[model samples]
Target: MAGPILTAGDLAVRLEQGTVAVLDATVNLGRPAHDGDHTSSSGRPGWEQAHIPGSHHVDLLHDLTDPAALYHFARPSPEALTAHLANLGIHDGTSVVTYDRSGGIWASRLWWLLDWIGIEAAVLDGGFAAWEAAGLPVSVLTPDSVTEIPAPALAACGQPASVDNVRAGRWVERADLERWLRDEAEATVLCALNPEAYAGEVPTRYARRGHIPGTGNLPARSLLAPDGRFRPLDDLRADLAGLLADPAPIWVYCGGGISAATLGLALTALGRDDVALYDGSLEEWSADGSLPIERGRADAGR
Candidate 1:
């Protein structure tokens, strides 16, 4: 079962409630440094300087990713994640708020990833900018005596669905995926992309370009409302349920296969099974030129 999306108006109702954890999930890809200083706050540091009175830091690139494979997917280690949540006093029943500055695009990743890991969480509508516009309370002092507790059980990578698992059922290679979507493969279901990165063609940057051939272009943003919250379950069901009804496994993708994890999370929230995200995505496929890439409506880069 899923919970309601908590907007600023709703969060205002529980400004200082019990056992609520606010997470600053600010993640900005490598940008030119304004100065020669490497010690400067990478996003999480700003949270320390000033953030929601009791907000905790959840660095998307660091805390949520695995060091061993960080260079590869830049994802966090399972142990590191379990410990990170514990430090924030997060547990099975803790209420969670995850947010970032990117119009809920990246924020959606944290929101859904937590769900994959079995935590009940949601994104703060409109992020910190919205919070500031509404005059919410913020402080520079870090939380005191934050406790970290290991999970009774840990699943590496936030329990994100594996590429192997998604290959089953209605999924196909680029050409097949296109045929399925184009009425060529008999699949009239809805589709999703792994992340924003693969929506455009970056041939040399990735193993391939574009998404599964016939799949509908349901960008991760499709599941979210303009307020930066997930749409109502009924609405999600109406749109996504049709895609799954055709019995063709709904396929998802992105560059390195990380965003696909986020897409699978949405499917879980909607209670839709029979769906899979191609973890290899374009990155793995493009590694070899023999693989083909198709340009659909999704190929138009943002």
Candidate 2:
């Protein structure tokens, strides 16, 4: 298979063979507004202390990203990305797999970035909790040194999102939210908020529970392996492709806006150009109470 999802036990075989590279894509939002210090790459120091054997930390926040795109962080140029991947010893032949402490939600960022660069990769199923439950080996060793090499130049990423693309792509709101329940008019608005919040639940700190109306439910966890990583590409594609068949936009969001970005990253990886990120996310949507808000039955994910 061009892309394959691996189980914790299966991953053990790959590690022993030394053909695949394991990466930690964990991210945490200490503050609802942004992914914080202990959650991102720079915070990845923990991986050195313990992680999947032979696994390298992808440093979700600090590395493998163009922070410059952010009003707060500078985006990374194509050159930066090339060098970044090289440092991790990534090659066209590398079979990349990732997982994190958080639900595959944040780890999706890693899965997406590789695909953006024309590299193939997948996330671990279930995640770390599942891995530990399986009694897989964990390690605290750091490779002696990492040599940075640049990959082919990267294409521009993280562009502004549009409603038309979202309306015409494969995506679903996290849950039926107040904005949706308030009235159909309220539900049919631009994508930028975490509908989860309005659902009257807080599945993730990134947003209020509830979501845009008429959205499907595909929680990040749906793509996970028994060990916390995402499923293989075939499986992942099968899940999302069905949604795509309908010609609906895929608008992803999470409170302050990082997780949705992660979703956008994932869609972009799966060869979907119509995907978009609600960068403003919930932070912007909640700002205007004038915007209709409705509360509806909450689906766990989409």
Candidate 3:
């Protein structure tokens, strides 16, 4: 399997060889407007204005999610994802590279989704910001049409572990999370929300405020350097010292699974493969009147 992280320079060379398909997976998760609508502004317009040459835009909100789901950004079924990937020209043999303006935050979500479906993909380390910083070229030209690619057979792709199984490699769902939280002894739940959001001081798209109970806040931005690249592994480990002490399972979640995927990628790079993403994240947890949520920080007794 290809590693989850790719450098901007490395991608440029791959593009020259016509060996990779790049997707701009940017999405803005800023606070809602005064009207209180949490609909995220799509990054498609920005990608149209400027993006990596030959890269296509993938709309997480529209194309990749289940349109029928009650929650925003719900994971689409494998059949749905196969169709979307085929339309995007992403095939079983294609090498996928995803990036976003906000570091690899949104890009990692696409990478995680691809991984869940048994497609090989990598996130551009540092994302578009770093690509520009390296004096790489950008393009305003859009492809006239999406190139159709052959999607792998569902059986060939292999069945992804049930969302109820957290012991599998990199993806988790609400039911799995609920079960783990009830009697978690070998797992640590990591919340990727910012301090303000985690503390319930800011307005969120969800029905409730704060984070999932028993999770510790590790604000998504904290994992990045000023330049948007991931922090050094040693530095990252230091910041997560409390959780790193134990060799237990680590489950990460964010507002709607995007930022949590970012943390998941970071953890994978740091050689922690026990990490899994809570797909519905707080989007599902908060809406239910029954699921418990917590405000402020308590020691995440790992």
Candidate 4:
């Protein structure tokens, strides 16, 4: 309820008043050195070098994901999330602000995850880049020096602490996607990868190449400006003109549910609430030999 997005200046004001807690959710994903190994580097080191003052680092790669999940960045169960949030000193009314150094995709992913539950939080517009551009102060203090705030006694009581308001259908699993394809549901499935990845025109780390069958291409990076901030609402409206006019629910997926969040944030900013994010995305989709994937482009969408 508080935000899907917050400007850097606004966040600064809130920080001045000690009204919000900031979390750096940066995770650098690089092309794998080998065919089977992942190349995700945590942002904690970067956050240690420089970060927004009083901000703590959240491990999106580990703490927030289910280790037992089949793929990377899988959504953790409510119980796991509750304990994780509690560990981070987050409870019912804590004002949370999330940001990332690598563009705003990772930050957007965290925001979407928080939104999936009952917690209300915001993603800092332009993320840490914009914060620095504004001449705001940065801190070198490590997380260990920071004192942990105790969660309220009622945190486990199913108030705001637990996933009391899990946004049903906000997260789409592989089965949900398969069901949509099988039933020919009136939904718009979107792939947020670039044109090359969508077309299987380049090397990919995923088990399979190309995209899910029938998905329209809407690269998530297209939603951001050169400054790594979201584009103007007017520009976004023009870009999404056709899709905005459609009544069907929009479902988005990326390499591993990371970049797709940019589309989710953009659509939410446009006042369209009928959006769902596929968490496993191509990471899980491509691994299965039975699932269908399409190569080449289609004139299905602008």
Which candidate number maximizes lDDT?
4
The CA lDDT at 209 in model 2 is: 40
For candidate 1, write residues 76-114 as lDDT tens digits: 434455567665566555667766765554555666456
| Candidates sorted on lDDT, descending | 4, 3, 1, 2
Off-target runs (Cα >4 Å) in candidate 2 are 1-4, 31-42, 71-75, 142-244, 256-258, 261-302
Which portions of model 4 show Cα errors greater than 4 Å?
32-37, 142-160, 299-302
Per residue, candidate 2 scores C-alpha lDDT tens digits across 1-302 of: 13434467776666666556677776544533432222323537666667776666666566754565532212244456656766566655556777777766555656655554555566665666667878987766548844222121112232321122212322333233443445442322233333444453444332234444444444444444655454566777787675545454455654544455445645555765666444444544444555443456444323
Each model's total of backbone clashes:
24, 60, 0, 0
Each prediction's Cα lDDT score? Answer: 0.54, 0.51, 0.77, 0.82
Q: After superposition, how far is residue 135 of candidate 4 from its true place, in Å?
A: 0.3
Minimal lDDT window, size 10, model 1 = 31-40
In model 3, which regions exceed 4 Å deviation?
A: 33-36, 142-169, 184-186, 299-302
How high is the lDDT of residue 245 in model 2? Answer: 56
Off by over 4 Å in 1: 1-4, 30-42, 70-77, 141-208, 223-241, 244-249, 256-280, 288-290, 298-302
By TM-score, rank the candidates, best first.
Answer: 4, 3, 1, 2
Residue 12, candidate 3: how far off, in angstroms?
1.0
Model 4 residue pairs with clashes: none
lDDT score, candidate 1, position 52: 66
**What's the lDDT for residue 122 in model 3?**
90
What's the true lDDT of residue 249 in model 3? 86
